[model samples]
Target: MASVTFRHTSVTYPDGSLGLADIGLEVREGEFMALIGPSGSGKTTLLRTLAGFITPSQGEVLIGDEVVAAPGRSVPVERRGLGMVFQQHAVWPHMSVEQNIAYPLKLAGAGRAERRARVAEVLELVGLGGFGSRRPSQLSGGQRQRVALARAIVRKPRVLLLDEALSALDEPLRADLRAQLQAMSKQLGLTVVHVTHDRSEALAIADRIAVLDGGRLQQIGAPDELIERPASPFVARFLGDATLLRGRLENGLFHAEQVPLAVPAARITPGAPDSTQASMDVTSASGPASRGPASSSSAADGPVNRNAPLTGLLAVRPEQFRLTAVEGSPADDAAGETPAGTSPVNGGAGNTPSGGNAADHLTNAPSSRDASTATGPGARVTSGDDDPPPALIPASAPARVLSSLYGRHSCSARIEWSGLEFSCETALWRPQPGQAVRVDVTAGTFYPLSAAGSTPAARQEGEHAA
Candidate 1:
């Protein structure tokens, strides 16, 4: 196991564009660090730097105590003691599985017996024990990927570099491979740096997540830590489903404009004793907010509003929203974006809280509008002779059961409440078109992301122009 470290690392390309700048990070030995962001976020660039594929214009790239990448002297990729898997399964098509796995051993000039034994061991490690003799062309996509993995670390390199190795697979196949990789990492004690843009992939697999944007590293930490407490607005919005609600704090305690809400932990690391519930906007895709001293609510709303302690930005996950068929009790807004004294759940009723947006509940929230709704033939709505066809759309805002799909053992529901699309998985649901569905959102998780830092994009752009 070898720790990979980068300090003051910066990179530039022949096109005069900057790839990265002021990079500083450390990947602990034997830990999995998943670097994620959009295509140009420099995730791949960082991985290449670690693999000794790209040279930096400034700074140090160190593995253990050795300075592998820096000014003047540099190490080559093969000499770096790192295992690498590319986006394409870079296995030699003509080589048999056994041959491919054993190739690394041969490269290191191990004798035939040792090479064969290591090949057998790694093939089983990647779950291809029985297919040793098959060539790459004979395997399924998953199988081929397994072969590729077997080849990557067959020599037991100190670190493993995965460059979106599973991005080409379908969702289910990708999920399966993710599990296998996780298991393999633990068993092998391999330090890993995986690069991808898939949010779910990063969330499910990473021990530490490094958010990169525009070729710069934004924030790095554990999965829940970054999601629940983002260091900036960019980080919050980039990682997952999150919406930014603009609000302000009054007198350093309550948010203005919306119902009274407390400052976020980012704002007041120690929320007062009375602060309890953090609110969010469900459609907003905000993450969890920090715990503070405020009246606790029944549930968290979108990290958008509930986590709305003092809102710069909120990240709300879809699963965090609580669905309701009927009206819910009123509560106060933490993010000042809500109307003064507004409660997110139920807008009106003496029992409800006051001062939220008077717009129809489905109007402002995006997830309420779904593109799909799951319904079976038998579950279709039948028109009665005496009843004029009920309006699928509301008088002003429309709600429709749009698109839905059924899997072998489960199904997903999609509905258009206002204009946004929101989907959820279920055991079974057969809601017909024009079915009146009441969506009562309980709350969302809020993550207070950093708003002050420069994203990789900015640095890259600046470097190119400079």
Candidate 2:
């Protein structure tokens, strides 16, 4: 097993197209790390750099403390002692499965008997035991992929690199192969760096995940850390079902043109003469809470001032918002009434509560919600039927349903509110096209972002496609 390290590495094309920028990371021996991001996010470039296919223009790349890439040095791909699996599978069609898997061993000048033994062992390892004599054209797509995987690992290299290796397979096949890959990595103590745009796949397979965007390293942490407490709006939106709103931070409140959102704290001081400390505090509804710094007041308090003029953004995940039907509104006509026990909150989206202890009262609730059933039009289901209704906080944003798409049990509704379109998930209840829905931005996980002198940008729907 071997470890990989990037020391402020960067890669830039001759035409000034940046591929990677000042990335520094460390992957421990036998660690499984996933690189995930949108298109043009440098995930593939980073993987290529590790495999010695692309040399860095600045800094260095190391594998097991040996410099493989740097400004003045380069290691040939073959001498790096690594195995790579590409998206195309790349199995030789004319060769039998055993021949293909043993090709690497033969090239390394292994004895005939040893090559045969290793081929047979790996054939069984990838579940192709009896199919070793079959040609690539005679096997299914999944089987062909297995052959390619076996070929990559036949020589037992120090590291394994997968660049969208499973993107070409169907969902069921992909799942099966993913499980196999994980098992193989653990069983062989292999160090792996897998790259893909699928956040869920990365989360499910990797021990640690690194998120990159625009050729820059955004965040690297465990799956839950990135999902629950993202360091940036881009990271949050890219990794999960999030709705980002452009707004400003003033007195610990997020103020959009037509929405009122509250966050745990304001950590950015606009044009401040002095620097302030920043930290992350995430409290999931059912999961354990995490905070970066110690505090007596609340986990949300940070170094920035409570009252400052800072333009920024807010990221609210789908599960963070509690959907409620707006009462006495034009769009409410299409909304059904609340169930007998549930109660509707007072006021519109703009009438949200300001700072003070309101942030505390609004954010703390049951850690989990029970499944709820929809009974009437516009009637929103709380987390569970037994739990009392959520506190009566005004709507953070009032929206009109533009369209509703049903899934197996949940529904995704395209809502228009304050000139912004949000593809947020709601309860299984199907709302009419014009139905009124009030979104409550619950306290604990509402993330407030400072513009940091950047442009107003938000992640669009379906950015997670692999």
The TM-score leader among the candidates is 2
lDDT of 1 at 218: 67
Q: Write the per-residue lDDT of candidate 1 for residues 233-320, one digit (tens) a residue.
A: 4555567454333333222221212212222111122111121222222232232232221112211222223222322222333332
Number of backbone-clashing residue pairs for each candidate, in the order shown: 75, 4
TM-score of 1: 0.65
- Candidate 1 error regions (>4 Å): 249-314, 320-466
By summed lDDT, which 10 consecutive residues of candidate 2 come out lowest? 457-466
Per-candidate TM equals 0.65, 0.74
* Residues forming the 10-long window of minimal summed lDDT in candidate 1: 334-343
lDDT at 330, model 2: 44
